[model samples]
Target: MEAYVTIVAVAPFFLRLLKLLTIVLTSALLALPVYAASSPEQTLGLIRHTFRSHRPPPPFVRYTLTRRQLTNEGFPDFIWTYTYHIWCRTSDNAALGRRVFRGGSYGSLEFLRPTFNAATDPGPPTADLFEPAPATKQATPAPIFDRLREIGGVEALGETDYQVLSAVTEGELIHVRLLPRREPERNRLRELFADRRTYELKKAVATDRLFTQFQSYPELYTLTLGAAGGYPVVTAIHGVVDDSTFDEAARYIDYTFTEISFPATMPDWYFEPSGYGAHAKEAPQ
Candidate 1:
């Protein structure tokens, strides 16, 4: 009878120990992705996979974009809102748009580009306005990915392109620091923060060495990403350009993506420059 009593007393303690262990194992499994990345390559692969898997549909996509310019003191100076209608083929991209300017000398401007065919064009493809203009030529609309590739000179993330400095966890995000391996790239140093669970890029800051006629200045670019149509999309971009040669205060520009979408169908003539003038009245405001 005494041995039976001792057995009953120990049974509850054994059950409690098993329960505690189960809870710990479950928590560790849930956090596997956050801690799984031991090196920069693995972290980069996760980001690359997210981008490739969430790529927008091909042929054409239309969306609205809002851009704002801010002063050095963080006051808004200019705001422009516009609709982007773009069509793309394997080798070419074309766009037609109308922009309404506000918060400054308010006005509206309509513009169209016929083609940015890679086969015959001298410059990179122009299909989106948010793209930064190349130094030699004027600003034009181009696909974001294409512009990034042209500027970064890298089609995909590779160990040779960046040297990872460090990775750390801050709350629910993993922040990583990296430096460019090559010169003349806009991304001289970059700090990227991503979601711990999803591994999606949340924010990034890039420091670039931009040169003018007299000297070089460190231009800082800040980017913020958010979810759009189940994929991470750039929601805001701000840049501070240092003025080393001139005594002028630093130049600050802010670009915001207020609206974005992937339209199902766009008319045939919408993509043609010759036909754009005729269809200006029909374009979405």
Candidate 2:
């Protein structure tokens, strides 16, 4: 063991490579006029088609995740931050290949860099990295949050579990809201408000009767979608989390996400723990 050390968060360097893509997407989305379809069914069909037309979500990605913590009184601060060298698709056995965690605010952040000397050090690969514990759990979500799950095409909406409440096209955005048909799902709400031009999911609001809920309040997730690459990555995820998930110190909290590239593939080492040293040194630049 090389007496493991903490890793440092990567700057949003990849974004630069992509050419300030977020700004471009924002500008494009705002200018593009959303043509409201005649009917909800037709609108849903168009959304599915539009998304499918794109290259598609890449198989591998890397980015920084910043989490902002807020008080019930509305005071906010940066509480937790993470830099994932490589985050695999949800279908992968491991959620993240290598990452660094810091706990604190901007000036006083407890950042740890991967300071291993790759050449001289060959053993005890960086510790405390990776997510999902490299274990696979195939637990199916209970038959609870059911109503509608758009798979393949629009007709699947008839009797899935979740039902579509409304699919409206407003000027430059498409807002599709969903609700559960059963008891537990009553307090729950699901919606997808996406940009018209790229059909990228920009706003998602829901009550995770399933997500942690020590206490509940009115909230919606305002996400920032970058319309580049085959399948644009959700560069930002802004939303609130309840007390239970927030460590019970606050009434409610707001959070967000910003990631980088979603390339079709990367080298095999990127997905392996030992391969971290090779890329770890590359993020800081």
Taken over the whole model, the C-alpha lDDT of each candidate is 0.53, 0.42
- Compute each candidate's TM-score over C-alphas: 0.65, 0.50
Model 2 weakest lDDT span, ten residues long: 121-130
| Clash tally, candidates in order | 5, 15
lDDT of 1 at 218: 61
Q: Which portions of model 2 miss their true places by more than 4 Å?
A: 1-38, 71-161, 182-189, 195-200, 209-220, 242-259, 263-265, 274-285
* C-alpha positional error of residue 276 in candidate 1 after TM-score superposition, expressed in Å: 1.8
Regions of model 1 farther than 4 Å from truth: 1-16, 56-59, 71-93, 101-109, 112-158, 186-189, 207-218, 244-250
lDDT of 1 by residue, 41-68 (tens): 6675565455455553354544444544
Per-residue lDDT for 213-240 in model 2, tens only? Answer: 2534433444455543445444454455
